[model samples]
Target: MNICVYCGSSLGKNEKIKEQAISLGELMCKRGHHLVYGGASRGIMGVLADSVMQNGGEVVGVIPKNLFKKEVAHKGITELITVDGMHQRKSIMADRADAFLALPGGFGTLEELFEIITWNQIGIISKPVVVYNLNGYFDSLIQMIDHAVDVGFIKPGNRKILRVAETLEDCMKFCEQEL
Candidate 1:
């Protein structure tokens, strides 16, 4: 299966997050899955791509033309696709992937995760969306979603659209089930 991964372009302060990213990539390879992600050669993105490539896994990178010109595209990926803008990049990634996973990241990662969940909610896509909530990174966000459900802003059933996994093993299990 082709798994779409949304993660940081900039690695945060924690080295463990980078380790986790690499582990996730290795897991994908062990499961015989291909990666479809934002084509960047920095932060967790680069680490994950490298791990997958090193493990002899196929990686498909979808990068925006602007970012590609900025010299952040992963040149060593199995396949690199350049799109005109962020929207097109996301669209193409989603279209090509059979499942989606989100690693801890800043605004960009959150945006991509939410967009995929929203797409599933509205029937634009039915693919599974899993969030790797490592070390409680997404605890507050999960709480906020629960609050939304309580206040009737979001339907209760829709809350299940975002599957939360605290470990790489759990994440892989979810992916396998989805596939």
Candidate 2:
């Protein structure tokens, strides 16, 4: 499986989030899954790519042209696909991946995850989307989602579209079983 991971380029203040990202990478590699993700060599991006490489798994990085010249691109990736802009980068990554997993991240990660989820809701892509709710990093977000259900802003059944895993092990298991 080629799994696309949407995560932050900057490691958040929480150390556990970074740990989970690394663990996920290693787990994916050990499971013989390839990784498709943003190609930054910093923060969670660096940890994920390095973990996969260390575990002898393939990693394909889709990076934008601006970031490439910004000199933060991971040179150790098995292959790096450079695009003209962020939208192109996201499209290529989504096209390359068979599934999507979102770890605790920032705005970029949220954007990527929301785009995939929205598309899934609208009958665009049928790929499975899961969120690694590391150390309950997404508790508030999940609460907000429930609020959306209560407020009628979103269909309550739409919550089924997202599978939240509290640990890397459980995340993989959920992906194997539910996705």
Candidate 3:
């Protein structure tokens, strides 16, 4: 499977979260899955890519020209595709991925996650979207989603579009069901 991962460019202060990224990469390799992600050689992104590479897994990085220098596009990945901008980058990533996995991240990551989910919801894509809630990182977001469902802002069936997992194995299980 080719899994697109949405994660932070900065390695946050939480060591455990960084560890989860590393473990996820290693597990991806073990399961013979390719990684599709933003091409950044810094923070959790870098750590994840390096782990996959070190474990001999294919990694296809999509990076925009604007962030090439700022995010330090990873040159050591299996394949690095450069795009004109963020929109192009995301389009390429989503097109190439079989599933989407969201890790702990800030604004950009959240944006990517929602955009992909919206696309899936509208029939632009039909793919599994898993949220790796490592250490309850996404508890608040999950609650907000529930609140939305309760308030009738979102349909309960639509809420099933997202699958939350606590471990890489669990996340993989959700992705594997797409097969």
Estimate TM-scores for all models.
0.97, 0.94, 0.98
For TM-score, candidate 2 versus 3, the one ahead is: 3
Candidate number with the higher lDDT (2 or 3): 3
- Residues 134-160 of candidate 1 have per-residue lDDT tens digits of 989999999999999999999999998
Task: Give the per-residue lDDT of model 2 (tens digit) for 1-179.
Answer: 88898888888798877787778888998888999999988988888888898889999999988888563999998999888998899889989988888888888888898898888788877778889887777899889988998999889777788888877887777666543
Q: Rank by TM-score, descending?
A: 3, 1, 2
Q: What C-alpha lDDT do the candidate models reach, one value each?
A: 0.91, 0.85, 0.92
Ten residues in sequence with the least summed lDDT for candidate 2: 170-179
Stretches off by above 4 angstroms in model 1 are: none
Structure candidate 1, residue pairs in collision: none
Q: Candidate 3 — which residues are off by over 4 angstroms?
A: none
Question: Model 2: clashing residue pairs?
Answer: none
Candidate 3, pairs of clashing residues: none
Top TM-score model:
3
